[model samples]
Target chain A: MIEPFTVLSSRTVVLPVDNIDTDQIIPARFLTTTQRDGLGRHLFADWRRDAANRPREDFVLNRPGAEGARILVAGRNFGCGSSREHAPWALLDYGFRAVISTEIADIFRSNALRNGLLPVVIDADSHAWLLAHPGAEIGIDLRDCTVRMAAGREAGFEVEPFARHCLLNGIDPLGWLLSQVPAIQAYEDRAACRA
Target chain B: MTAPRTLFRKVWDRHVVVPETAATPAVLYIDLHLVHEVTSPQAFAALRERGLKVRRPDRTLATVDHSVPTAEASWASGLGEMDHAARYQVRTLGENCGRSGVRLFGVNSARRGIVHVIGPEQGATQPGMTIVCGDSHTTTHGAFGALAFGIGTTEVGHVLATQCLLQRLPRTLLVELEGRLGPGVTAKDVILGVIGRIGVDGGTGHVIEFRGEAVSAMSMEERMTLCNMAIEAGARAGMVAPDETTFEYLAGRPMAPQGEAWERAVVEWRELNSDPGAEYDRSVTIDVGALEPQVTWGTDPGMVMPVSGRIPAPAGAGHRKALDYMGLSAGAAIAGQPVQVVFIGSCTNSRLSDLRAAAAVLRGRRVAPGVRAMIVPGSQQVRAAAEAEGLDRVFRDAGAEWHQSGCSLCIAMNGDRAAAGQYVVSTSNRNFEGRQGQGARTLLASPLTAAASAITGKVADPRPLLEEGRRIA
Candidate 1:
């Protein structure tokens, strides 16, 4: 079940790499499990671990001051490969409430949104600003569709109103769609009558 | 007045269940939904949690591909290693499909194979249809003039509960291929050339319509190979307008319409092409005749060049990083680069024709010493067809491991993987870092290219081998 999301403010981690694909977010080897739990432990497993399976201290997630970061500021073309929802599942499991990137892939964006993970698209300047200032607290107001940086700057973003409604209500779109089945049937009936 | 309609617009407009309003995106009805083991388990769980069943079970198909081992032992037992997580995932899919009254092509089933390959083989994928799958390569169905794209696991759950997807219409891009493809240059080479020219994110936010003589000349399977990697170009989907080739391929398949139904379907499909004066948001043309067999030199599919070309100098940070990871130097020739492993499989190029092309090169030759080569058919049906013609024996005699069908060594989720630090020439789609295995470098190529490389143990061109064979004959 997805939690209702409205406003979130938290310290953000900066991952300044472009085209961070779903495979990097969650490797295919770790995808054998059906359950979504415990995936955060394997997030970026290849980059986070050495060949001997030791944790690499140089990686950003392993660095100090990166703990409990609820927002991720990433590079362009984020989530660029595969249609695996494991990418967003791992992010949400890792305690990230939102992701800020210059661009997001089509399937990844929809997946993240449906899973209650906010995918915020901002201008390159704002992205650079957020990356330059590490551990900065960023604010996301989904109700207003704007992201506020720690430096007192604001950028507007867009989300389909229906997705927004679903997110705000903490409801799956499937239920709403089921409710509209009668209307859909009526439309089909009218088309058949016309034919 | 409205604008003239492209092929994408024609198909999409016809499938819209509800037009877009201020509050929501259009609810587009899905004609087919292909499910695989890797992404459908959680979707089934989600459905169970809500006490819901699949809305249209007949329109949905399930297969165990991504997490299934390609070894013959596993095929016989319908199981891999006893304690592996992949076994549980594959088993869970069978249970879910059985419980939901949805059909599944399990390991024991002769029709079982990769979702993308089996769909068209069964005649389930057709022109003017909207298809969705939890795997990105679902774009493979677009070759039949269908509007197919990948969806996330959450969206998979939604689609299971409702046979509709709420989607914003994607803009259309026209990719016109001019001239005829030269001999020995296959559709894999054509797509690789396009990705190299356009870069990785070139087609983002657009549905690409591949038009002109070259695409029209391609066989249905060849067109599928072209469309299978559209996601590598960041396109929402790739499509080729339906023609006589499309009709001929679907005529006798099991799920295809028969007799009068088939005739009526062909007439409607013929009208599915873009209007002559239709305008796309963006257009680009490539002379395919001028191209050669292409290979990826870096992590991404976009870092590709013709086999006769030299490695490019690093132009950006990404290029430098890709070069560093791939253990390649700037300005080096891609040819003569030694490869330790050669894989001829994956949805990209594992069809019957692909196997034939590879077999043609390996019939009288042997794999180079110290090279590990394997040939995995895309599906059980493909495997059966290849064996009926002794293609399997040809591969095995040439020192290649001919294995059962599934997605093997493509992503290396199963036991199949390249050794660390090994360079692999593969016929799979992606060559991203550690895509074949941890710390393994991969070069994406056609089956013919992979076959030639297996013989020489390097990035060797297949043209010389083809010419030599023709002269000998």
Candidate 2:
């Protein structure tokens, strides 16, 4: 089971670009390993590295005071494109606990929730505030379903109840499904009998 | 059962193993689970970690794409020119599939190809089925009246362990095309035109049901080309009602039922359409009769314009960023933009029909002096069919590389890529920045458009070239 996600308080790393797709999060070339660990090193590899594989100093993650930022404030349509879970795995491995965006792609939102990495969709005004004040302190509370900024401005967000329950209780989706083996087998057996 | 219901309601209702409650989602049984090397390794590893065996290995089908090279010798060589990591990933899938008891269309198998292509080709994708994979384009199967969509690896693991998925109900959007397509327009152009009308996130939280005269008139492969880009429109999936054409495509295939069962299946499939006056949550209508050939002049699929039109002024931040990344300015004609690379493959349009159309354009012509082009068959079956029809000879004689069946240059995970700062006219979906390669600018277009661009070395219209069809032979 992944770590239980409930309340998270931290400074944020801002990337003010729309449609930041999974390809930009982790390039296809770095997706070879079967293991999920160590992917944090390659998160945003193309944007973080130069032609010679040296770290680009101008990148948001590589700059000073960017280390250990546990939240990401990104633009709209964050995590679009491929359904690669490597995108969220890399994000969580890179020390992000939550992502604040104006919009998030469907499959990516599901993937992030399963991994206990929160995907928070806020209003445009709140998102603009986060974009303007880079490194702003913010708090996310699953109990209240709201995000609180440093300046007392806040916005309510939506999350599926079951996904929220699993994240709230450190419950894994596969584990829950495994517990329903009898029901699944019965369904199949009935279909087989019909055939 | 007599109440009016949408097509989505029909398929989704039949697959519910356990209904949703206030707290949990419906546990839907999947009829087919298509797997690939890129997304399934971790899923198998997770099963091993949990000491779990595959609940229904019979329903799962795996393949080696996204990581395997497409060189002439690569299939037989096993390791071929693949780097250490690529070779490792391919081998891992083999080991995983072997230990899990799932059937794998390995690198050397004649049935191997892009996951989407081989499924329909083998008849594993059929009417009234609920299909899924770890790739976003799994919506391609919805052409056969199936309720299909992509899932992430975590859900992949869940399905592997139980042969089921937990999902909330998605809203239905009826996208109706009023009339038949124009001469030069194709399934790709129709999809592009729709995505351009609705922004990328317009279909978010909904599954699109395509209905009308144009959809009814298209072939099964053409319907697949239209549905394949549903994800680009941020749709959960895209669907079309099954008809006689769908049954004809599935008949006599190895995986399809024979004799009495086939007749019974057709009867049931006939009832899979939306009833008269069934309501959808939302609706949109487009007139395909007057549409022009479409092309993406920016970074995303929604930033598209007709081939005969000029790029429009940016309306917001997203369009501005797209134009900046594409190195284009407003009011410039999308035509005459030079391209260095041309790719004509992917799940969107790599069928035999697509190959024949491209070959028809390049029949007695040659690729431009500086343009590098490649035509990757969607599957081994497609490659063999093209070879038997002499289409491969046409492509090679016209100076395009006739690559083997694999996802080459589309995802670029197999060491096939356009160089930095190069312009590429591609038939694949998703022209996101760095999707083809780092700093590569991709213009998404129909296979016919891509073929014409390869000949002219610039973005060009395909209608005139296609109208010049009778001159050959």
Candidate 3:
């Protein structure tokens, strides 16, 4: 049910804060429905709104020229806490095609990739450059696995080749795994016989 | 010949459905798959959309936890005062489980509890198994020597369709704790001390094996508590070798093997320890005797200090921000800091033993006048056991509310929250901003420390209070 992703060029929203956990991305209270569509409205709900339901002027998403940004440039250890897939759901629902960070939590990175949200890990210099220029256009070439800043500075990153193949083909791993059922059953049978 | 194996390698290698090749990660077969309401709804929907049946429904278990109310009235009335959206998720879980033919412990079920607590209590967690849940706290099951970790919703759907996960191998780290723990110090303190020493991200991309004398001396519940916080330390999973203590705990549980099967399981479990010549990618040791009752002073679990210690000076911008948010001054003592609430419950420390420990401190005492203290048992079974022993009476007489089981106040997903700016001493893990409630300050501690703080309305140590009671007796 995911769209195949290959190349994306979009302006980046800068959020230069480390350890921005999944809870911050999408608070637990907002994780009410199974449907992933409406979650974009609640993304960063706590940080975006005051207790009185007024929008916070200083929050990055509320600032001017922050709309329609498809790439998020964040700090280190992004999406660090909780195994809530709601975090990535909110990000993708909000139109973020990719997130660039110096580091991403292991679980979050896996979740993002499986959901067709590209998690781009760049060097400190590239991260700093993106953060320094808010609303700057950045290009991600999934075919080549490279990230390019608007100034033509580029960084090559690594994504698991299999995950890349799945994303490029828009294939759900379950189908592939289902095809390997015979092999799985064989392994189980062999292990049981040994036992 | 293969190298000698650490506990992690031994268990991980046993679960490999397909070995890692040039193009794909290894396909690891899961022995148990725990599902909760919060993360499983989408996964079930995904299955429905694809017209796929749950491949191994027998291996999967479901429960409603995060969105369930802990109040007895809510259970009595079916959905009393519960929000519409929250009730929808729980109801959907029941419907999904019914359609998928997977067993679910509904809100009113006697077996209902936090998924992690129910797994061990029912003996679903076993040695040398691969367990997956859509919850990070699934690491708590690793205490049984299972290679358990949380996965995302998509992976949850994949596991439901095929009882296998594609995972790359993780490095192993051996965390050894030598010497005996001092009186009043609990597993929570030890883990807090470990996280403080290692920092939050120190265990990234690794599986940690907790070994040595202190870990060996811990009870099954204590071991679970230690492994539960491994995620807080950034480890993918944490495990303790299954010993006689582990077997003893699993022996009579409902799902545990019996008779000949039980005997065979024990024989295999006994061999689960790390080989003598095994090598860990990293190893560190801590002297348990040197630990004290520890508490978090800031927003994260890593910003911890001993109860007897002073607040540390800010070391960086993060530390300064944490201090400012906590409303604490550097160099000031944490002992007399005022607390408005004390919560004793969570998958981390909500077992029968945890309740008994807190009850011991609350007996013949009353909660301090302005503090709202509550004890939510980990499960329905734990609640029944506590009431049989009159532990609930002790908590009630001491002015603490005794509530039914669920993850209450830990993540505050079910309308259970502390007031903004209020300082709370909680027995649950995670002190992240607004984890307890929006703008609330949480100090993570053990049940004993939380009970003591409830009585004094401040951060107080339980050792002196316990010893004083002994002297009076």
Best by lDDT: 2
Task: Please write out the lDDT profile of model 2 over residues A1-195, one tens digit for every residue.
Answer: 778888999999999988888999999888877888789988999889986789999899999878989999998899888999999999999999999999999999999999999999999998989999998888999988999987678899989999999999899878778878888989899978865
Regions of model 2 farther than 4 Å from truth: B73-79, B471-473
Chain B: TM-scores of all predictions: 0.98, 0.98, 0.99
lDDT of 1 by residue, B1-473 (tens): 76779999999998787888888788888889999999999999988988988987898999988878897676567563633788888889999999888889997899999899999999999999899999999999999999999999888987898878888889988999999998889999999999998867888899999988999999999999999999998999999999999999999999998988888789889999998799899999999988999999998899999998999998888889889999999889999999999999999999999999999999999999999998999999999999999999999899999998889899898788998889999999999888899999999999989999999999999999988988888
Report the CAPRI category for model 2: medium
Clashes of each: 0, 0, 0
What interface RMSD do all candidates show, one decimal each? Answer: 1.3, 1.0, 1.1
Q: Quote the lDDT for B27 in model 2.
A: 92
Q: List the candidate 1 regions with Cα displacement exceeding 4 Å.
A: A184-195, B1-3, B76-83
Q: What C-alpha lDDT, on a 0 to 100 scale, does residue B73 get in candidate 2?
A: 63
DockQ by candidate, in order: 0.70, 0.79, 0.69
Each prediction's RMSD over C-alphas, in Å, is 1.8, 1.4, 1.5
Winner of 2 and 3 under lDDT: 2
**Which tens-of-lDDT digit does each residue in A1-195 have in candidate 3?**
579999999988999877788888988888888787778888888789977789999999999888999999998888887999999999998889899998888899999999899999988987888889999987899999999876569998888888898998898777778887887888778867856
Please give the distance, in angstroms, between residue B388's alpha carbon in candidate 2 and its true position after superposition: 0.8
Residues B101-194 of candidate 3 have per-residue lDDT tens digits of: 9999998799999999999999999988899999998999999999999999989998998888998899988999999998889999999999
